[model samples]
Target: MPPYVPRPIVVDYEEACRIRDLSPKASATLSRRCLQGMIRDFHGVREGTLAKEIEKIKDKIDPVTWDSIEAVRKIGNIGAHMEKDINVIVDVEPEEAGLLIGLIESLIEDWYIARQQRAERHAAIQALAAQKEAARKAGPTQGAGAAQPNP
Candidate 1:
């Protein structure tokens, strides 16, 4: 995970990874919570359930990415919410949990890391533009061997 990610999100994601093999359900739940935190923190969509929050950002993201986010939400939902019949146990396979974790990794890269990179690039462009503008304002310099104009 990138160092810029918030500590709480990193903690949840790390915990999810730690238990993915031993307890897929717990891992999925943690991943789901981590996803929700990302949505709320990054996208500024904090008004409703994870599903609704995802819906709010549907247009903001590409269809494929939106679908992937929805998939994570559904799989994580299995661990988060109980079935109507309490006797039934719907298990999330280790592989599925791993996929959720992978999606989170992608999102962190797509959203946070990409945003930081974009900011840096923009700042660089702005700095160069300022340098050019300052140079233009300073007027053209005379060659060292050029003759001087009389006052």
Candidate 2:
């Protein structure tokens, strides 16, 4: 629903700054403190829902995708609690955050893609099932056991 986890990085960044002895510098595109606030809500990710739904359609997806989503979810937690150098909590240089950003992005992408594919597969299953039922009822029209050529 939201992003991944509900908390934003900005809040933690600010807390980090307080713990560390650094002030927001001029060149940093995002000070962890303020940047976290900008992150979208990520708490509503329904792991239970996803897990249950995925179980029904796992065969239609790339396993790697599922793994990526899981990794992103775990990393999100780590990033939330990440410590910067000097406890700023540690420095998350732009380049470093960039890598993490990539992971997060990939994770989100995989999650959505998997979900869509799963939905499609589910619909297909229902359609096939319905067709089979219809066929079953229309059977034996001209089989060997049919009425004796209507005499």
Model 2 CA lDDT for position 131? 93
Cα lDDT listed for each candidate: 0.93, 0.43
Q: What CA root-mean-square deviation does each model show from the true structure?
A: 2.8, 11.6
List model 2 lDDT by residue over 25-44, tens digit each: 21122232222232223223
lDDT of 1 at 103: 92
Clashing pairs for model 1 are none
Q: How does each model score on TM-score?
A: 0.89, 0.37
Judged by whole-model lDDT over C-alpha atoms, candidate 1 comes out at 0.93
Cα displacement (angstroms), candidate 2, residue 32, comes to 9.3
Return the number of clashes found in candidate 2. 16
After superposition, the stretches of candidate 1 with alpha carbons farther than 4 Å from their true spots are 142-151
Specify the poorest-scoring 10-residue window by lDDT in model 2: 24-33
